[model samples]
Target: MDPLILGALVAVATIAVLFSGVSVATGLLIVSGLFLVLFEGMWALELMPDKFFGKLNSFALLSIPMFIIMGSAISSTRAGADLYEALERWLTRVPGGLVMSNLGACALFSAMSGSSPATCAAIGKMGIPEMRKRGYPEEVAAGSIAAGGTLGILIPPSVTMIVYGIATETSIGRLFLAGVLPGLMLVGLFMVWSVYSTWRNTGLSVMSARSYSLREKLEILPRVIPFLLVIVGVLYAMYGGIATPSETAAVGALLCLLMAIVIYRMWSPKSLWVVLRDSTRESVMILFIIGAAGVFSYMLSSLFITQSIAMWISDLDVNRWVLLGAVNVFLLIAGFFLPPVAVILMAAPILLPIILAADFDPYWFAVILTINMEIGLISPPVGLNLYVISSIAPDIKLKTILKGSMPYVGCMVLAIVILCVFPGIATWLPDLVMGPVR
Candidate 1:
């Protein structure tokens, strides 16, 4: 059989299995192993153990679990609620201020946790009820946090960016830095839409449930400021080259745990166990998928499928922007099926070379890909975020959540276009701080 044909079959089969509800890591592993045996014989199968080990052996991969732990520690506590409350105190006077605060809180927590579902679960648990209690529309109330939670992968300390850096051999610090501007840009865009939509749909009088006194506003800071500091510290360490991504993650995780203990009094053994257990479970799931993806990539390369695809793409005679548009569409669709990390692991290696050949900056492209994944998180079929919001706010219809989120999805699409026009939004910070990539 033609390798290209087999490659197409394998790709389609992976999607079918994922949609069939088999665990992503398991499905990828089974597909890779079976295809390897049938296509390359027993000897090829035998080599996979060492191959998968070599792939997973990276020290940088350690950051993923630590990042998960950092997120889990906060989500397992009232810190997310604290973070949202603090934002509301400051922003409550503005129209749709509460929702804006939710978006802001999502960005900050996402920077800390680096997991979208955790962000959704954490902030939504508080923000949704608060918004609803204030008489915000159910769609706006739920849609805001659902869309905002997608920031987990766009903000710094992002797990997906870490995976992309590892897969493409790009600098993790640079990728984190690359995400900063675009992340902020998206936050601003979301806020703008929220304010306008609230003013239009609800009215200018809309606000939080009540106002806080100056002292009340200031009091909450003592509890949440330290967590905010954790975000700043991690980025500073990454930006200053003070530590590697893994070391940064380790320190950030420690600080978050310490804060959860000292501030939230989450020091009981069961609480600690819960954080560690949740983090470990998610970490293992991601790592297992990564290990399997390593095998899958090897299979594609061994079969000449990867080369054929890259060459086929390279040989296309189209304007670079047109090619870029096609890649964006492909990523958007792929993201709807796979989590950002899995997509990065499987696709980055294949796409990075093509992106470079097209004269697109790699870091800029990372932001663009992330925004696509953000849309995926809020869309259907496999929109993890939609279901996450549904679980948290059981009363809000899923279709309403989807409807409310649709505008923000358009906000994301607009963000992508803006980044394309000014790629510097993603590249300038990294270049200015680290010096241009040679």
Candidate 2:
């Protein structure tokens, strides 16, 4: 059978299963396994274990579980509440100040937590109620939290970046550094949109700017300083050459536990157990997806499906920018249905070759891909962050949350355009600090 025809069939099967509500990991495994055996025969079965295990058996992957644990620990503590209060105190004078504070808290928490739903839950619970008390619009308040939560994957210590780096064999540290500017850029865009939208709408006069006393502002710092220290430590360890990514994760997780127990005094034995249990479940689910994506990636390579697609793209004689734009559009659409990790795991194998063939820097492309995934987290229908915020604020309908998030979605798109036009925004920091990842 023609590989293209086979690839088309595989694509159709994948879409059918995914749309029918099969888990992404199961769908990929079943589809890839069936294709491998059907096309390559029994001998290919001999190589399956090595492919799956090889993907999972990496030093880099160790960081994933640790980071998840750290995130879970933080979520189970008072850190989110503290951070929210601190930001609210500082930013309350700005237009849409409380919403802006939520965005700021999301960005900072994302730097610590590395999970979108976790970030949303952490800040949303605190921010939404606070916004409500302040007479902010429900859509604006919820939308800001949901949209800002997507930053979890774009900021450093992001699990999505780790998965992308592992899948593409890109340097995780370089990827982490690469995300810093783009993440901040998205934060700025979201803040600007929130401020402008609330200010422009007369109904939200309740969002008028107001300042806090200097002493009141200073008093909140102690609440946030412990959390910020963990973020700073992990980053310095990783980017400053003081530790490997895995070591950095280990130390960060330990600090999170200590903060929860010693500093916050929020951890009893039962609470500790709950955090452990939840983290284990989330970590196992993600690692399984990684392993399954490895199988699918290997099958695509062995089947020459990815190579065939790349060759076809190369043969088109189209400009690289056009192809890049098309790929970003496709990813944005796919993001509505798939989470960032699955998208990276599944899409990276197929897209990376074509991207490198066009002479685009892999590092720069990783940042672009990440920003695209970040948008997906708040996208309508299946966006994880939307669901997370909805669950927290059960009275608010999902449609309203989606409606409020649309402007911030525009902000994300604009960020993508900026990155495309000036790849330097993504690359400059990594180059200056890490010196180009060798």
Clashes of each: 0, 0
lDDT, each prediction: 0.87, 0.86
Off by over 4 Å in 1: none
Question: Which candidate leads in lDDT?
Answer: 1
lDDT of 1 at 190: 91
Cα TM-score of candidate 2: 0.96
TM-score of every candidate relative to the true structure: 0.97, 0.96
* Candidate 2 residue lDDT tens string, 1-438: 767777788888888888888888889888888888998897887887788788899999999999998988888877888899888888787657788889999999877877788889989988998887787778888999988888888788888889999998989999988999999999999988887777666455766556789999998798679878898889999988899999999999988988888877865899899988999999998998999999998888888888888888999989999999999998988887888888999999899989999989898998888888877888866788888988999999998999999888888889888998898999999999878655
Off by over 4 Å in 2: 207-211
All candidates: CA RMSD in angstroms? 1.5, 1.7
lDDT for predicted candidate 2 compared with the true structure: 0.86
Single out the weakest 10-residue window by summed lDDT for candidate 2. Answer: 201-210
By summed lDDT, the worst window of 10 consecutive residues in model 1 runs over 201-210
lDDT of 1 by residue, 117-151 (tens): 88899899988888888777887888888888899
With a 3 Å backbone cut-off (N, CA, C), the pairs that clash in candidate 1 are none
